[model samples]
Target: MKYPIIIVTTILLLSSAVNAQKRSAPDWVLETKEAAWQSRDSQGEANEGNFGDVWYSKDGLDWTELKSDVIWSKRHEQSAFVFKDKIWIAGGAAEPDYKLDSEVWSLKIPKRWFRDN
Candidate 1:
C-alpha cells in the first residue's frame, strides 16, 4: 500500500547518500554558520543582478556569507576567488567609455585572521 511506497522511498534515499560518500576522501570540516553578504555592485547590473558573492560551506550543511570590500559601478568585468583565506576582485566597467583593465584589487579582512606569510 502507500505505507510500503513511503518506506521504500526513504530507504532508497538513505542508501543513495551512503553510497555517494563511499567514493570521497575526508578533509578538514569547518561547520560554518549561515550568513549573507554583499558583493561588487549592482549599479550597472542586468535588470538587477549587479554583484556576485559566495556562500561558504564547511560541512556541506550550514553556509557562511563571504563578503567583498568594494562595489563596482560599471558593467561587465568579472571577479573571482584568487587566494587562500580570501577573495580578489577586479575588472569592471569604469568611466572613459567601456575600457578594459588589468588592475587588480585585494580586499582586507580583520587583523586577527591574518597569518604570518
Candidate 2:
C-alpha cells in the first residue's frame, strides 16, 4: 500500500518537473490556421474577365476581403510585389488575344508613396 503510494507520488513529481522545464523553454512549434482568400484562380481553371477579388490576413487565420473592384485591369500570370511604399504588379498575360504584356502599376496608399520602406 505504502509502496504503491510512494511510486505514484514519484511518478507525479517527475511529470510535474518535466512540464515545468517545458514551460520555461521557448516554444518551437508553429500554430497555423486555415484562412480563405479570394484567389483569382480560387481554382486553377483560368477563364478571363476578372473573376475574383482581394483577400488578406494577419495571423494567416482571419481574413478580410475587398469586393469586386478593378484592383487592376485584366491580367494573368501577374507578378505582384511591394516596393517604394507601393505595390507593383507587373508582367502578365492578357486574354481576348492571349499576349505577353509588361505593365508597371502603383497603388495610391497615402504618405511617402514613392519612398521605399
Candidate 3:
C-alpha cells in the first residue's frame, strides 16, 4: 500500500512539473488581438481578409510561424482536421471575392502542405 502511494505521488509531481514548463503566448498574438479589436471598434467593421500565413502552436498559447514555398490562395472559413496522421484543410471561401472553394489540401506532420489534386 505504501509503495503504491509513493508511486502515485511521484507521478503527480512529475506531471505538474512538466505542465509548468509550457511556454506562454508570444507578444505578437496579444498585439494582433488588440489591434484587431481596436480597428473593429473604430471602423465599425472587421476585416475578414486572409494573409496566407500559417502558424502552429503546440500549446494553445504559444505560436510559431511556418514559412513554406508552396503557395495556397488566401481563404477564410476553412474546415481543418487531422486524419491518418495528416492535417487536412478543405471547403473554404477564397479571399477578395469570397468565392466558395471545394478543393482540399493536406499536410503531413512536420511537412509542407500539398493540394489534393
| Candidate that scores best on lDDT | 3
Per-model lDDT? 0.36, 0.38, 0.47
Q: For every candidate structure, what is the RMSD over all alpha carbons to the true structure, in angstroms?
A: 14.0, 18.6, 13.4
lDDT at 28, model 3: 18
In candidate 2, what are the lDDT values of residues 68-92, reduced to their tens digit? Answer: 3345455556665545544455656
- Give a tens-digit lDDT track for model 3, residues 1-117: 122323332332243444324322111121121111000011112273454555553323333456678846766566666677666767666666768889897766555889996
Ranking by lDDT: 3, 2, 1
Candidate order by TM-score, highest to lowest?
3, 2, 1
Q: Which regions in candidate 1 have their CA more than 4 angstroms from the true location?
A: 1-37, 40-75, 110-117
Runs in model 2 deviating more than 4 A are 1-42, 46-52, 68-70, 108-117
Q: Evaluated with TM-score, which candidate comes out highest?
A: 3
Better of 2 and 3 by TM-score: 3
| TM-score between candidate 1 and the true structure | 0.34
Report the C-alpha lDDT of model 1 over 36-79, residue by residue, as the tens digit. Answer: 11233444434543333333333333334454454333434544
Q: Positional deviation of 109 in candidate 1, in angstroms?
A: 1.9
How does each model score on TM-score? 0.34, 0.46, 0.56
TM-score of 2: 0.46
